[model samples]
Target: MKKIFIITGEYSGDMHAGRVAEILKQKNPDIEIEGIGGENLKKARAKIYCDHSKMSGFGFSIKMALDHIALEKKVADYLLNSYKPDLVLLIDYGTFNLRVAKRLKGSGIKVFHYIPPQVWASRKWRIKGIKKYVDEVLCIFPFEIEMYQKEGINVHYCGHPLIKQLPEKADREQFFAKHGLDTTRPLVSIFPGSRTIELRFLANTFIKSAKQLQKKHPEIQFCISHAPNLSDDIFDKYINGTDFKVIKGENQALLSISDSLILASGTVALEAALYQIPMIIGYKGPWILYLAYLLVRCIKKVSLPNIITGEDIVPELIQAKFNTENICYETEKNLYNKEYRIGFIKALGMVKEKLSDKYSAEEVANEIIKAL
Candidate 1:
């Protein structure tokens, strides 16, 4: 029986890895699928080599640095020891996974990467590491193919997994009724992000933005998405001083029903785009990381919709620019201005056309199985 070991460093990666594992099992039930993942992977019936919560977070300290090294040694040693996998699949978590890729050098283990780093967006230097270590990249974004091919790295363009994986657009009326939100009011939802650090930088600003909007349009209702991965204590620490209903889980459903969104830059922005939900992206982090990003970022656009279209479809406010004033200004344009809102939603509609229609998980599974 063929065995594959998957490594993922965070919740989103875990979810994507879980989907691929589910399809891989269907394609070859006798094959072994084991990985470091969370609930999603466990549900897909992949063996839990480790839970990624320890691996997921923001910023880095000496302790964090040490923890990562220890975890890297643990995973690499485990893979080389008694549980040698036929193939090693690295899913996202570019920083950690790339380090693992380097450690696996000369080990004779074939490594295939799914949802590889967005070299087109930032830190193009990382592509050298990718080219050196990754045998093949199972990429999600259609445009990444050209970048990889130009650099002489083998890449396969699998349609973005979210296109197939996202739940159907929720019934707005039903969703509102279940949440006890008034259907008559325009709903604005804030997604500070899945990480505790994100809440630190963004939850207050998002709350303030919502308050600003509500002050002007008193009838507008509000909710905040608490990523299920985060503990309640972490969310409550940053989210207070507002009565906005905190909706835990059901992120897609909330996105579907929301009229406009205040988002922290991440895959959720892409998910909102898929639903044609209008949103503005705001993100702030440590000055050191921001400066590092500025030094290496290849593109001006941060949000996926804007990056994908090469146009400003969704407004991005990052670092110093990511303030309550900017978020409310951009969000209100999408909320109150009919022409701007319609135009924004139409631009989002075109993103799907720019992507591959191929079923991503099925294609990914077939590629991995074929290589095996």
Candidate 2:
């Protein structure tokens, strides 16, 4: 059996890698695996060299520079000399993955990039880096394939991994009963983010917005879904005096019961769409990090739902737009207005159509088998 080394950066990447690898394994059970990942991939039986928590953060690479460099060199050297897999699969961990890609450029191991970096957004030059290193790039977005192809990279549009995870019409009663939530009252869910920096920037703002809503309508219930990467103390600190409950890592369940959501932009927004919940997406990167957004013109949209459907299905309040007042305003619109709810659900249905029914893991597994 040939060995395949899988590399992932954070929780979402780990989750994506785990699903893809599982599907690939099902298709070819004889292939052996090894590399860096987290709990999900570990459960999938990938021999993880390192867990992703040491490198999880938004913005500057300088924040985790020393540790990032250490891990990068460690993982890269390991793949190059230790396991020496037949193929090296790089998931989205822009800085480190690129470094690993560079080191393995001429090592004879076929470099397959599963989730390409956001070069279209900030580091277009990274395509130059990718072209020099990666042999085949599998992209989730159809647009990405064209972009990388334009840059002379062998790219494939594999479709997004999220489309396969769709649940049957959400069982609201069962969900509520399981979580012990009241169905009669309006449910509002808050997701600050999985990172500590995101919690610092948006947690207070979310709490303030929730408090304002609670003041006006005591009948409303505010629920927070804590990203497992972050601690419960983070949310507790901000919501100490307020009447709110934090549901650790139960983002999906919390969103299912929600009439509306206040969440950080990215994967969670996509999840919200699947649940058919009216949502307001918000994000805040440091000032210097925010400048990176302009440097990378490739990122057209921040919300996953919008990117997948090629249109804004829900309001994305990024950077300056991500404030207490803005969140409250959008929440009010989505919750009280009949038109907003109707329009959002209609857009969500279209997003669902754009995605493949076959699981992402299954599709990605097929790609790996064919590549080998």
Best by TM-score: 1
Worst lDDT window (10 residues) for model 1? 54-63
Write down the lDDT of every candidate, Cα atoms only.
0.89, 0.79
Which residue pairs clash within candidate 1?
A: none
lDDT of 1: 0.89
> What stretches of model 2 exceed 4 Å from their correct place?
57-63, 234-239
Among the numbered candidates, top lDDT falls to 1
In the range 66-180, model 1's lDDT, one tens digit per residue, is 8888999889999988688889999988989998889888888889999998888898899999999999999988788888999999999988988888889899998988989
- So what's the TM-score on candidate 1? 0.97
TM-score of 2: 0.92
